[model samples]
Target: METLIVLDLDETLLYAVQNKLERDEDFKMGSYFIYKRPYLDHFLTLLARDFKLAIWSSADDVYVKQLVERIKPAHITFEFVWGRSRTTKKRKSVTDDYYFVKRLSKIKQKGFKLERTLIIDDTAEKSMLNYGNAVQVAEFTGDPVDDELLQLSNYLQTLKDAENVRIIEKRFWRNG
Candidate 1:
């Protein structure tokens, strides 16, 4: 039973903001400043060992690809990479930024079953369509001490053998 772990880029795995500072940790990629979350590489390495990995970010292709390349090197593996083009176009609200939603229904069209798939994103609204299979983590904002990824890895390890991902997610959501 292979479980799919869908990761969000941008503020979830890394935080990209205006690069006007002189911080050595800041990666000036193109027009934005990107910072790797604390223990990012280790977290990815641990998760990749137990579950099939994939990236499903709302960022544009060029941006997402660049970020993925930086984070997951050749040795690290990813089953799929989906950008804004593959997501459902939906706005958070009238006054909110227009974000493409990660619709599990659409992902199912690509052969990924909801019961075996889990999505981790900072924005709860982005995963609203598949909230049961989503783990809403605290948005990564370049904090050097941030440990959300490590914590998430521990939680996922517990679910790796579960019959259904949603059952475990439901329990967490209730307690959360």
Candidate 2:
């Protein structure tokens, strides 16, 4: 069975920096430079074999589109893309910045199975709506030695035929 993998762009896959001065390994995406996580291309290729990919980001549409265009090649492209407007707006608890919640129910409404869907986000709060279906990761920020994706790919490979992703995620991906 093919699972749906919902990915968050910033922090999860890459870190975007607006100041060119701070960027050494730059992936130019319009006005910003994005630093893709280590082994990104290999990770994507692995995932493409077993699951349909989708990008769901809190960033604006234009920025998300530009990043996707730069990051994805011919063999790997998102099955669908969702941007800031697709997220649910929530009031800020401690700061002026409001939180954007990724409602997995929206994806479910579009016919993606909740049992087979897995959300990969760095922020734990982003998975509030579908906690059981999420596999949280430590936020990536241009670490050359980072092998989180490589490890995740191995874990996911074991769950390629899982009837429900939640059980596998809880068993193998929960906590530290």
lDDT by residue for model 1 (72-128), tens:
856778988889988888765768867678887776777878899999899887898
Task: Give the runs in model 1 whose Cα sits over 4 Å from its true position.
Answer: 20-22, 92-97, 170-176
State model 2's lDDT. Answer: 0.83
How well does candidate 2 match the true structure in TM-score terms? 0.90
Flag clash pairs in model 1: none
True lDDT of residue 97, candidate 1? 67
- How close is every model to the real structure, measured as TM-score? 0.89, 0.90
Q: Provide the overall lDDT of each model, using Cα atoms, as 2-decimal numbers.
A: 0.82, 0.83
lDDT of 2 by residue, 1-176 (tens): 59999999998998887765443865676667778888888999989998989999988987888888878867887878888989998877778778889999898777889889999889977778888788888799777788889888887777778889876645345332
